[model samples]
Target: MDIKKEWIHFIENSTEQEQEALQVFLNSLKMKRERKSLTHIASLLQLKTNLVEDKMLEMEMPNSPLLDNSIGIVHGGLTATLLDTAMGTMASLVPGNKRGAVTVELKVDFLTPGTGEKFICRAEVVHNGRQLVRMEGKVRNEKGVLIASATGTFFKLAD
Candidate 1:
């Protein structure tokens, strides 16, 4: 079946809450797609989210022409965006009444130039509190070599 048909079928079988969540995700995807022209390269690179969890998550993208720098390696800003997105997502997993969090600080260390078919970023929460969250992020090539690492602090917003 085509993707649209498959999506329709899935939505038809989903519960009300699942459908609502799916709608939210789809709306977010649509907004990202529509606002591409207004977004920075790094923001566009991080817009794609592939994994989600309460305290951890991973995102990946295949090496493509759009992601390459003059030397054919993933750009440094793209790597930094991946790290920041991962850490921010981890912070969002903090338990609460679902108040939002904003990144207050982020620091990234580039271990090596990333030149691979695929890039993966993993983020985990190290500490969470009522008002603050700390997270660590790592980027790896398909071969599991660490390409970059980062730490972030996020502030929970009042609901």
Candidate 2:
């Protein structure tokens, strides 16, 4: 069967709780499909925050099995991706920044297991230059328990 049909079949066989979980994943997928942008996929996974120009960028996401690892905590790769995203978002807001930045390097320290109802990340630009931006970010739970910390360098593209 095709992927869509297979998804329907799986949903039909799943318990209500499982179906609800699947729905969350499907909702994000649907929104990304509608927007037709990878950026939209990132936005779908995150909640809005006070991430304005030249200010700290914050992003949050709810606890969902779709983002969890085999042991039920958020996956490390996802945590790193979110960290990078937070930094990049802040980089884009730097003064005189004519273009958005792409990750040149990202280093994350998984300080603790990511466990909570929601994950929150906050980032700020440490150094904004013409060609490179450096940012630092931290991820915590809703209860303010630190999960990870990251520092990243992003390369600014030409206008």
Best by lDDT: 2
Local accuracy by lDDT, each model: 0.76, 0.83
Q: Cα RMSD for candidate 2?
A: 2.2
Off by over 4 Å in 1: 1-43, 46-53
Tens digit of lDDT per residue, candidate 2, span 1-159? 999999889988999868867777667777677874356648456454567445588888777766788898899998897898888878877877777888999999999998999999999888888789999999999999999999999888788
- The TM-score measured for candidate 1 stands at 0.68
User: TM-score of every model?
Assistant: 0.68, 0.88
Worst 10 residues of 1 by lDDT: 37-46
